[model samples]
Target: MVLQGMAAFRIICVVLLAALAGASTAQRPTYRAPQHTRAPLPVGATPEDFVAFANGGMQIERDRAPDDELAEHRRLVSALDGLLPQRKGMVDAYVVSIALDSDPVFGREAREAAKVLARRYDAAGRTIVLAGSDGTGPSDLPRGSPGHLALALARIAELIDKSEDGLVLYTTSHGAPIGIIYNDADQGYGAISPNRLAAVLGALGVDRRLVIVSACYSGSFVPALANADTAILTASAGDRTSFGCQSDNDWTFYGDALINHALRKAQPLAAASAEAVALVGQWEQQGRLKPSLPQVLIGDRATAWLAQLDRRTPAATTASVGRPATALLDQR
Candidate 1:
């Protein structure tokens, strides 16, 4: 009787160990965009616009003298390009890069990401808009363009008017207590307060939105974007700098790893968020850098919706494209 009991316990222990091993092994290294069973954007509906805003353009050029930041920006854009949706109504993307210098690191990545997304979703008939500053201009706006904020706001309004649904907004730059830094003045730095930004985006009524802000003090934008019904993701919490960018690199650890994993087939949004947190934590531990926290704010319904999407994803790369579950989304 004693021998039988011991044997049973041994079997249970082995089973538990195997299960733990499998779970750990199956863990993905990065964030995966939530998979949804919901149908792709409607056939005739205009596709969402992907808006990318990079605040530092000159970093790329400066790096050239000593291996500029441009290389990393370029890499980032390339990765985005490959992840772009192929069809128009599915996922249309646009990119805008702004910086103190003409070819700053941020601007370059913005352009590159835009180009890559355009190629992947070219057949979808979505338009890719690329905007940037040459640095020495007024407020860093494009030559002959309107005021900085006006032009930036106008571009967003135009995109929203053209396609009301399916939009993702990405902003990467330096941030402080107020908002993002537009320029450096002898007296002080110019920044965009989160309230002002929220109002701007709210007015556009971007019903479906993904807004990513990567910078120090980025947490400030979360409340605004969330209030405006925009799904918000921030690179760091309040008063923290988002680190990781070298010449020609695709991303700092956060953005690069997130983007790479998010696009993998049938990834759940929750899973993506969890993975992002884990990756950031690991990077900090290894490098001794201050830890940066990534946060996600999604609508209540988005959670289960993302989970269902996993079922629709092709099990393998070779799997044929299947019909989207538009009806299922409607049911939800």
Candidate 2:
């Protein structure tokens, strides 16, 4: 009986020791969570993580198609090299480019132009792009649709909502009696009235708003967004269509001209608008379509802006309007 009791006690002690060891192993110290990854978000954390994750995924996908993606990267980087000034993280001025490629409903020219601009922004390591098709488009898109356009507006809100500096908008699309269309899917149904766009952009209270509209009768966008620091560049009057490239079958004549020719000299938005107007007028006269003349709606200090560009950046390249390098922007 004494031996039996002693054996039972020994068994109990062993079992308890094993259980304690198991518990201790299970309770090993856990690693600390990352600052940005805690249960609650940190104060002053811009949605930068979300943007970074999205962009990183996009880059991985792009790498899967190296040949095509690499060419696109080069093109966009070239555009950025020509357009944006290199600086530390925050750009004093913000340029947003939105391309509505998914809707397949309208505004092919505008969509293409958006791709160009987005690529430009991306190469500069900026997330101001509001692109939907991952940077490419289907061969054909319907005219005067607003589906993609609306999406672009929403993304712009996300990017610019908390931004304190000046913001510039560059848009290209098809236009009509009602408003601008992102594609055929949105033509009549999804059209964003100029008033609605104005309201949406105005809600952000941007210090400066510059919009470039490339479409038939794009002139209508001016009155809506016009304000103390706003400027609008329209491809044509309300009744007319703007001519664009046909080889690639793109219809964005205004974007091709503005970027390839007028902007090459690195002029301010005001001077660039003037040269674009004259060039478009000349191109329109030559075409059988009798394209509408481009117009500029300047802010109160428009000339001051033009002068400011002279002080800020080096002079634009002196290449003529019809140069071959300019051909890419006009191509399909």
Candidate 3:
């Protein structure tokens, strides 16, 4: 059997290649606004805002945001009009990938992950990505935030036929025990607790879905989202933490093992997940760091939809790319 518990050995490593990624923001909102009335980060936020979040708490006040900011957000959200409708009689997969933090690492991971997921699920025009500038040229894609995620899900719901179509949602961010965090550099602070996410999906009726969350303490989402028709994968258990969130790196430990390595092959989710967990455990041991204890939950009813999506993944696996996450930890 695979190792049972595994994450916290950073003390021995001379090279602090990455900081322990920390989650940001305050409590989740009690009620969610409708997609039409959703909001994004303010156009102008002071560095002090980031300091506040760094200090462990911030009440995001984008509700009184300026007109121009709201206008820009509207344009970005409106761009989702390009998400093509599903062809009748065929099962469709809509991929939504987002980087909740402004860290370039998450941006790179989220962008590439969208491509991988889209190709795997055959979701060409059915894909939507939300991320911030990673020192790359101007991008029309809106920054990741709770509002935009809600908007994307709501839009996909309209286009996808609930009977057979599915949603592949991938999120990369620093997670707290509370939930996956929503932090954009200095502004847009909040957490998407399991309850909140469960409510949203339950409300939208997006039953056939695959959600992969990369963040510390991400497994906490399992109990809420797990069901006969849903599959959930997390980088770490609810109390443990993951690695390779260094802002400068290309992939987090979990991202590299799962997406860049295991999923690249035409294997079943169980095999891929097993490979990823093994890789993560190996790295944690090598780095003398505690294991993040990656978690996976596959419901029985999800097997059919998973098989359908698996049939379309690339025939040949791609060569692994990017710096090794453990090496980053090894470097001083």
Best lDDT goes to which candidate? 3
Which scores better on lDDT, 2 or 3? 3
Q: Which whole-number lDDT from 0 to 100 does residue 309 have in model 2?
A: 32
> Candidate 2: global Cα-lDDT?
0.45
- How good is model 3 by TM-score? 0.80
lDDT of 1 by residue, 254-310 (tens): 554444344333456566667767777776766667877777787664443333334
Candidate 1, position 52, lDDT: 13
CA lDDT, every prediction?
0.41, 0.45, 0.74
Give all candidate RMSDs, comma-separated.
20.0, 24.3, 9.8
lDDT at position 234, candidate 2: 80
Candidate 1 lDDT (Cα, whole model)? 0.41
TM-score of each: 0.52, 0.55, 0.80
| Candidate 2 structure quality by residue, lDDT tens digits, 61-108 | 111346654654554444333444334443334555543222211123
Q: Which stretches of candidate 1 lie over 4 Å from their true place?
A: 1-103, 115-164, 183-189, 245-250, 301-332
Off by over 4 Å in 3: 1-71, 137-139
